[model samples]
Target: MPTLKTLQPGDEPLLEAFLWQHADTSMFLRSNCRAAGLLDEGARFQGTYVAAYINEAIVAVAAHFWNGMVIVQAPVHLAEVVQAAVTQSGRAIAGISGPAAQVEATKSVLGLSNRPTQLDESEILFSLTLADLQIPPALGAKQVQCRFPHSDELELLCEWCAAYNIEALGQKETSSLQPACRQIIEARQATSVHWVLVAENTLVSYSAFNAALPDIVQIGGVWTPPALRGKGYAKCVVAGSLLEARSHGVKRAILFTSDDKQAAQAVYRGIGFVPTGEKYGLVLFEG
Candidate 1:
């Protein structure tokens, strides 16, 4: 039987090794850990790390952080690790997210009701390799300049980030996200990369690297206003962003989008991202 262990202060190397092993598929878990050490630190680092071991060999890892959201990157059989972590932490999680079946199985073991406050069932995971990057052609005769947000544009990026949360993640009541978003913008500006698509001095689309693992970076918070859809801004911005990341020595990029987001999927595919798996997410409220 596998044993569950809460990572300690000195376990950084062990956790890094585990995450590096599954970096491509579990980029979120790995990147988040790298961005913030395995200790609770407000919104970004608000979590703990749990590992599952079989006879001293680490086989699975998870994060119970930020509103009790548990993100696991273990096999289906090891879901008990997630349940045990949640139960031990005594935190009423806002949600659980990961591979589809794994999330459901963990939820079951945790005795969480199937009727969650919010559920996203159609998340498709896609990844791109540095092997064959197909940079999308510029949209048209109209030039779309893609670059990082200037200092003065931080508020504009925050608004787009909020809109992304509300529209993509179904976060209707996200007054709390403003402060977190501000922190996020600052963190990204300092540690990671942010890319924006501007047409004629107007922001049209946005995307950024959420985490940077040893050889992989996860792309997230991609958004374009409804009024600007179907014009290849997403494709252009993503392509440019990937190129920038590569220039900085990243070897791979991964992103998740709703399954029905055919337009976004098309944009990703056009830039060499291939569907690899599905992700599941649920939100529970504190009663």
Candidate 2:
């Protein structure tokens, strides 16, 4: 039987070892957990990290928080460790899972329905094998340039990101994301993270990669300005960023997007991102 336990500092090495064995599924979460750990130390947000141990061996892990709504990520086993995690939080939990089967299993266990929504059903997780990545030649009327932001561009980058988040989250200007954006900018100053900004004569979209692990690089925070939609800017930026990952000796690149956005899904497929499987994003509501 598998037992679920809270994550602590002493478990880092053991968890890291588990992650090393199951890098494909755990890489992204591990990287995010490491970043979140730093944020927790700074008192940014408190998080509950848990691991599932089977016969004293770590098999699965998850991390969540009690911010306004409960948000969980990549719950490998929704019926097992995930349910325990949600129950412990004592809040309505929302998360992403592998596929219809796994999702339905979670729903049946939790007594909920798989009502897909714009935010909830967002992109299927996609990946490209490093050996399969084809570096397409730069083309078209739109110029594509990719670079890591320097100290001088940090302020402008943060401002651009704030605007991007407001539009993406569909929240008003007063949202707390403003400071979260600042935190990300500050985090980039450290060597563990990389921020790639794609500019077409000006900053248009940005993508970030956390390089805590040597073999896998997770792509996240991909955003394009509202005015820049349908201009092929997203495709250009994604391609450029993937190319950069290859240059950095990364063997795999992984990312997720809303499943409802067919156009964005097409864009990822066009650029060679094959859907590995479905990933769940679960949110817990506070009673």
Candidate 3:
């Protein structure tokens, strides 16, 4: 069995090298680590980053966040090693998310009490290579109108995101969400931006390339106002986001959607995203 080691302060450099070995799949883990490194207040999360090793060579990596979000990327059999590290941390796990088979495999060892109270099981993961990207010319150019909003638009962005959390992620609005949204909007990453879709001066939809590596970008927080959905706006905005990514020289992009969201899946396919696989897990909350 490989030994599990918790990452320490200076271990980031080494840990990063391990993560980049599979950068496309490890985008979430890498993104979280990079954000924590940049944000002064990120220390509050103090979540555990653990890796399994054999004879000094790193074999697998898992990030268990302060918010109880555990994301793992490794062979399905290594799920036991991941379970041990997470259980030993004694932190309450709010959820586990990863590649479909791997997340389900990990749950078997994580124990029943730690299972998710609410689950977004069977999530379809999709990707868009440069060749796969298809932006409807008129929608991408005119109707969608996607771009990075200025600082003056922060308040409206926050409000839209708060509503997004409620409708998309099934969470209530709180004081912290707005400030967090503000921070993301203010972040000046060379390759990242919060792309919002505006129609007739009103913010209608939005998406973000929250995590970017040398060749891949991970899309998240995609939302269209409830009243605005089903009108094909999301498809346009998502395509625009990918085009924006192409402009930044990113070769490919990834996003995840629940299997139950057929309409959402249709939107992505319309823009030329192909489903790669499904991830299964419980967003377990600690009682």
Candidate 4:
């Protein structure tokens, strides 16, 4: 049995190298490590990182983040190792996200199966290589311009983000999301941007690179107003964002969406994204 051990400073590189092998599933873990390192500094993205190793090689990695998200990328059998790490850290875990099977196993080990959760879902993972990207006629003909949200559009974006939370994350309150939406709009990510699609001077679609590294990006927060959807705007915003990331040397993009949303899936496929045959878990607990 591989014993779980809390990681210290300087262990990041080893963990990173291991995670890179499973980049599609480890994007969140990798991005968080780069942003917060091994220690919990009580800052956004900081978390307690742990590992199970064999002969100086990291076999699996898990983290319980400050925001109460426990993200892991490990073999299903190693779920116990992940739960042990979370327990040792004594960090509150309001949610668990990871590979689908692994999360199910971890949830069982952590005895959270019966706990009421605000969100417990497994989303299909999609991957796209930027070289194969297809730019839609909407963008190619300039019918809609896909660009980063402007500072002056904060209120509009905030409303969109709130609606997105309600729809995507099962968040029930719109009034409570303003503070978080403000942080997102005001954030200046050196490696990321939230993109918006505009046609006739109206913002019609929105998306963002939630986790980004130089080589890869994970697309998230894709939202279009109900009245504005079904017009291929979602594809434009995502594809346009990927184009910008590709310009800066990002080679690939990934996203997770529910299986029931055929339209959303088709929109992604239309832009050249293919299912990666993997599942992503996004289980969130109510506060």
Candidate 5:
């Protein structure tokens, strides 16, 4: 019989041990942060971390949080355990993010036919399996330049990210993200690298690639200035970042984008990133 228990800070090492055993080489974000973030007071988040054990040995773990959505992450074999955990939560809706097959399996087990509202379209996760994704030498004439962000680049990156949030969310700019962006910059973890792209000395776009695991890097926050849209700057920046990540010994580069964004999806495909499958994000509303 498998027993489930709540997670605590002391379980960080054990959690990492479990994740490393099953995660692909490309993921880098430490599981501890995921576990802790769900409980952080400043974020005003509430959640649960469950460790599934068979006798004295741990077989699986799941991190579920409550904040309008119950997000779950667990190993594939432990789907039954996750199902049991959700049944205990008594929440109407839940979200799960992981490998495409595992997510689908969980959905089937739950009988959750309700389509996802926010990230309804499959959050297509793409990856570059080859290391030789180099920029064509002939394209050098296009005047595309990439560089690591300088200390002075934060403000500009922040502004560009704010604009990205508004455009992506289809909402007016708000001050909420300012502090969160700052925290990400200040933390400066080894697994995270923030880059900015410049065209003729004007900041046009930015991208961030974070190590999700020892060998896996996840590309995120690819944003281009509104006025610069349709100029192909987004592709250039993404390609540059993907190349850089490959150079850093990343075996695979993964990224998630909404399926509805056909244009963005096209850009990624053009750069050699083929979709693996759907990544789900389930939302559980507050009662």
Candidate 6:
């Protein structure tokens, strides 16, 4: 039987090494640890980490974050580790995310499989090495400028975020998502993680690195307004933002999108992203 326990302060090196083996599916867990460590410090990125071990080596890891979300990267002994994650943390799970099969197993163990949620999805994971990134013709030709959003653009960015939450995720309650959208835009305002594509002095699209590490980034919150859809601006902003990230030493990028979104998937493929043969789950409860 595997031993399951909560992670401690000094377990960083081993935990990180184990997580790196599952990097694409472990972004939330690894990024949160990098930002806030194992202790649930009552901060944005802090969480109570749990690990399952076999013969003293970690075989799986999970965390129940301060925001009431659970993310796991359990490759073995799924039910035991997931159940321990919830029982040890004693936190109400507002949602859960991770590898598709793991998330389902987690919800099953936690009795959340039947719970109603605003969004529940299993999306195909895609990734690219920045060196293979293909710049959109319009971006390379300077037909559109890619730049970070201005501090004054918070409200606009938030609005676009809300739209993204609705259209992409199938979440209906915009009001419930507004505060989070605003907070993210405000918090990341001074960072290069968020990028906007402007044409003729007007914003046409938005793309952001929702999760970041020294060498890898996960793209999310991509939105081109309804009026701007079907014009290839989506690919432009993504490729342009990635080019900038590459210039600054980021070596790779990953993202997950619904399988029904064939057009969007094709756009990403056109810019050198290929399916990583992994699936990620996302579930957000309605408040």
Q: List, residue by residue over 1-287, the lDDT tens digit for candidate 1.
A: 77788877677787777767666556667666666677765466557778888867678877788657888778734566776677666776777777666776767767775544545453778888966688556743438878888889889888888778777767665568887678778877876478889988899998888667656777888889889998889888877788777887878888877778788888889879898765644444333
Better model by lDDT: candidate 1 vs candidate 3:
1
Which is the winner by TM-score between candidate 1 and candidate 2? 1
Tens digits of lDDT, candidate 3, 115-155: 44534565777888966788776575695587777667777
Runs in model 5 deviating more than 4 A are 8-48, 55-59, 64-71, 75-121, 132-142, 169-172, 188-192, 282-287
Question: Model 6, range 85-185, lDDT digits (tens) per residue?
Answer: 77877888889999999998888888888899988999999999999999889999999999998877779999998888888766776556899888888
Residue 215, model 5, lDDT: 59
Candidate 5 lDDT over 26-58, as tens digits, reads 142243345244342324234455667765555
> Which clashing pairs does model 6 show?
none
Q: Estimate each model's TM-score.
A: 0.88, 0.72, 0.82, 0.95, 0.70, 0.95
lDDT of each: 0.74, 0.59, 0.70, 0.85, 0.59, 0.88
Model 4 C-alpha lDDT per residue in residues 1-287, reported as the tens digit of each score: 67667888898888888898889999888888887778886687788877888778888877888888888888733675677668766878889988998888778878888888878889999999999999999898998899877778878888888888888888878456788877776663333478889999999999887788889999998999999878999999999999899999999999998988899999999999999999998888787
lDDT of 2 by residue, 1-287 (tens): 57778777677777777767645445545665565551233233345666788778677765545342322332354466666656665654544443334444555566666543323343467887766764444523335676676787778767766876555544356656678677877776655355454554577666676334566776666667677777666666667767666777877877666766787777677678898865634322212
Q: What's the C-alpha lDDT at position 232 in model 1?
A: 84
Clashing pairs in 3: 100-279, 100-280, 116-284
Please report how far candidate 3 places residue 169 from its true position, in Å: 1.7
